[model samples]
Target: MMISYADSALSVLPPLLAITLAIFTRKVLLSLGVGILLGALLLTDFSMIGSGEYLANTVSQLVWKDAALNSWNVYILGFLIVLGMITALITVSGSARAFADWAKLHIRNKRDAKLMTMFLGCVVFIDDYFNSLVVGSISRPITDRYHISRAKLAYILDSTAAPVCVISPVSSWGAYIIALIGGILTAHGFADAGHLSVFVQMIPMNFYAVFSLLLLLCVAAFSLDVGPMRQHELNALRGNLFDETKGQPPGATTDLPEADTGKVIGLFLPIAILVFATVYFMVSSGADSLAASELPFSVLGAFENTDVSSSLFFGSLVGFIATVGLAIQQKVEWSMLVKGMVVGARSMLPAIYILLFAWTIASVIGQLETGKYMASLATDNIPFALLPAVLFVLAGVTAFSTGTSWGTFGIMLPIAADMAMGSDSSMMLPMLAAVLSGAVFGDHCSPISDTTILSSTGASCHHIDHVVTQLPYALITAFISIVGYTVLGFTGSLMAGLISCSVLFVISIVILHFWAKK
Candidate 1:
């Protein structure tokens, strides 16, 4: 039974309630549950406001039936588990430590250490969770050796995590976005719409993510700093890596079976397997979609048409097997490997829990027709020229409030598509890019965001400290993105807009480099 609710301004209440409770209470899981419960109550027309019986029925039918039972959702769940296992096996086999030791031999200064951290985070692009966890685990020891502030390390980790994932078409974020946009466009009767082709085009227009990366490059290259981050870096220069007033986050010590430190292939092989396997599976699975679509198949086209679930599952599975196989070859016993897998899986509980609740909330939002309601409201009076910017702001707010970029994608993509259906392709593309950019922006800043949590957890930094140090940079990039979208709306030229935005981003970064106070 579909749990239907009135499609009006009131439909926004569920997500609003969830977002409110999350921000104030900082109890994300409980807050999201309450939000879903609130939506259920409203769906029942408030007749079941205080009735657990009604809420139970709602959860059983709406959340469980509609959201969790989906095969792709299950695939994501499995991928998360396998990824955790891979991380653990690497750690317990001493490959990660050996890799870290190898890095230490090459990095001579704090600047190089920070750059390398960011570079590794970008390179490991399979998933944001893995990026944060692995980069933080391996790089923290090296960063600490140079007295790099935990806050700075957290910022680098967080910056590279979501931004890189959002832009990389092969990342988990890519699969989610492709499915989302494709579904929306197909529903709206976009006859010639090729989701992958459009997705490939929007990469340049995803200004927040694109510029956030460029800004990171500038910051890393020039050693730029501003506001609180500058203070943190300066304090580190004085051999103070953390604030004395703040309680220090306890660092984790890994227990690993010894292996040869020279065997760096043990580390590189797993990651390489994950990337290569995913691409190979994607290409293989997409052969039919490619054959069916307008021919001349490209990598993005093949991937967008492919089975995301099977590819990701197979990729992560093979990566885990390769990792375990290497661990066994290193003379590590099965008992130790199994224990490490269990430990790694346990570490991901918080993020996994958050995704479950987020999926539930997204299901509730869909039931309420919140996205359609939003589309109707915005289209009624909002001018077409300003629509992209408005959608960008709306998406940013939703993601910031909900603390989930994927959730934001679920809620806002449909609305953006509805608004774009009748618009020209050139005009429509920026709107899509805006939705993506905003989702990433909001997720980066939200304290309850999984990426943010993982980033701090990975860096062994205080969570709030990471949020504080990262927000200014996120906001700056968001502002630039919003302005760029507005320009794209006016000019309607993808190339011109991207070039201008690129110039603006570099100028802003240069200004921060010399003028912004350290």
Candidate 2:
């Protein structure tokens, strides 16, 4: 049986220390590393790390093995590397430049450039990791030509990645969420309402995801800026994407390896193949699962049965093959292709390291059972009408502290499902929506979060700048989400709550824009 630490208040300390240090120091990597170290010490019952014999042993066992050497941890790192290579291949082939030129005719102004970035972000919903890197690389040139701030560009990339995936039922995110919810249902001996169906029902109720995209649209279309983003935008208007007199940092130096012939096809076709393959593999996996289970045929049924991690890896691999094959067809030599892949992988090395630390700290926190400890606090006595909002805060804090949305999902989905099955059953869908929305919102802001780091890397912006500029926007949407969840929890009216939240999002943004640089 799995160990439980639901009553242990010490469980939350590791992640809390990480969050506090990250915000205080603005050094995410160091903060995470120290947090993991502190967690290890705590795990040893507050043993001193500087003491004689235990130091090397603690560093090797906890930091290296327990955190980094885990299998799934390696796969996630590998996924980022492969995705980086694909983006690099696209850039090295001149596909990104060609796309930018093609976009020039249709994109005549800053709004057009921003809109294109926003549109691409929404369209590339296969995986959040893919979306951030691919969209940033492809859209940055256009945004740069129009003097759009890298901060804004990063915002567009960051906002779209997680929000789009959660709502996109065809994404790896969807499959993972389905499996999580389904596993919970099965554990509780209540599996009739398929995870996919429940997920679909909760879609409209996902206030943060839905509104985050909308807020991105508003920011793009209206040039809305607030807080630190306002300063960034104003600097961009003066041709300073960064607020430094050092001028813009030079971008990657990779020569085009292919002729401009079929540039659009070379760029977009490969992306489409990747998306289609990912969806195909996911659906295929789901279908196979359904067949083995002898379940009734339904679209949602297939999704609930899907294997997300396997499908993500499979789809990305196929996409890599397709992209390389497309490059050869376009007369690109194998040497240049290999070079591009290397360059791309190298570029992603920093991000991969950050992920390594993030996964490690999150693993340490998991070992501490932080989520269960928090969930234990959410007992049946809490009013159902307040549960969704409360759970949203809890999930958000948990995700922010741990810096892993997937980990948050794994922890919260089962707890939310159980709570729904308990006395306060009316809040199931709302609570479900709350958990999903909160995870994305928190992950969006956390400096150590993989998606947050990827968004900055993808946009080629300074990582801290991305984190600094985007947090206010994420918090605004999250505030709207909390209010929306509260309404939903109370009345169980998805439409009313969503509408109120939507209106609040627009109005609050507009008001903030006025308060910002115009």
Candidate 3:
């Protein structure tokens, strides 16, 4: 029988230890492995036999859950492999170089380059994974031409992805959250126009997501680079876009050959196809899911029920075919084509390894009930006025420890709803907003987070460098969000809270910009 550690403080140890080690060592796989082993040990009460069995279950959970195939994990991994190959093919065909050369004619300055990147990041809000990877592939050449650091590119990619998705009604994150919130609202006997409106209402109140996007714009428009990001930007100006010490980062195309005759269509057509195809597949998948449940179809409803992983897989497959076709049209040799495929897939191996370990450790953390233990801290004793702030902090801690915002939401949203219903039911929306803000903040900062890892991969930045450099920016936004939540809790005025957050965000950017200049 599996043991339950939900009530024990020991539940938090493994993730804490793992995260700490990862920060200090910069060894992601090692850190996650250590955390997983420790969690297994704790779940088994330090018994060898029990630990082995517990670990086996965790591994099983990674690929199979409840005797059913875990298509999400499998399809996501497949998508990564295909994406890597596509990235490689784009380079080997000289499409990347062609794009860079073409961008140079139009994008005259660093700021424009960055603004374009941020713009793309916002426009591709269907899914965080798609946004991060596709935006990285497309904008990388332009940003690279302007000497933008891979770390900065990764930061922008990371910032725009989850924050945008959390607010976008048509996104995978929004769909999932709306469905989950519908269940929570039903359970609490709260009636409204629908879950979508409730989610839309919470958008302005999602301080972290709102402020983080604003901060991204400030960073690009005003050159408000602060903390580690400032140093990375300086290094890039010195022609060090990547830390040579870390060796080649994932998605690096240094080894790939570029054809002199490569055209811009080689780059644009493949990615364009990828984006449109992915959207098509996403809608098609959602329609099938909705039909299975005998529900009427709507675009938002389709997004809510979409199979994101499989959609990404099929979409990427189509993009890969387009990429190969373009390469052949460019008269690329058969051997080079094979080489691009091999090298592209190989580049993703490191990311895939890190993801597997991260997933396993996350599974272990779940089995240990780490999120439940964290949620257990915000008891009935917290003041009604402070519920939003407290729940925000709790949700942040849970997401940071668990390295999964969706998991954090699954654990905390219902709890927030229940607590608000028991206390000041009027505070329910703010409390729910707090959880969303905090979870995104935590997921944004966690080194083990899949989006974080993918952001690094997409920008071809070293994972540790991406994690370390983005921390200060994410923290600042998080700090502003907490203050906003505190204001909302105390004043019961969303406007007051939003004004507070907006003012603080602007002030922080101004201060940081000046500080960074020195």
- The prediction achieving the highest TM-score against the true structure is 3
Residue 224's lDDT in candidate 2: 78
Residue-level error in angstroms, candidate 1, position 182? 7.2
lDDT of 2: 0.77
How many collisions per candidate?
A: 0, 0, 0
lDDT of 2 by residue, 433-487 (tens): 8999999988998887888888887787767788889988899999999998888
- Sort the predicted structures by TM-score, highest score first: 3, 2, 1
Return whichever of 1 and 2 wins on lDDT.
2
By how many angstroms RMSD does model 3 differ from the true structure?
Answer: 1.3
In order of lDDT, best first, we have 3, 2, 1
Please give the CA lDDT of all the candidate structures. 0.74, 0.77, 0.91
Off by over 4 Å in 1: 1-6, 46-70, 124-141, 144-154, 165-201, 223-262, 287-301, 333-338, 401-426, 446-468, 491-507, 510-518
- Candidate number that wins on TM-score, 1 or 3: 3
Which pairs of residues collide in candidate 3?
A: none
List candidate 2 segments past 4 Å from native: 1-6, 48-71, 183-191, 242-262, 283-318, 321-338, 379-381, 421-424
On lDDT, the stronger of 2 and 3 is 3
| Better candidate number, 1 or 2, judged by TM-score | 2
TM-score per candidate? 0.77, 0.85, 0.98
Q: What tens digits encode model 1's per-residue C-alpha lDDT throughout 292-322?
A: 7757776666666677667778887988889
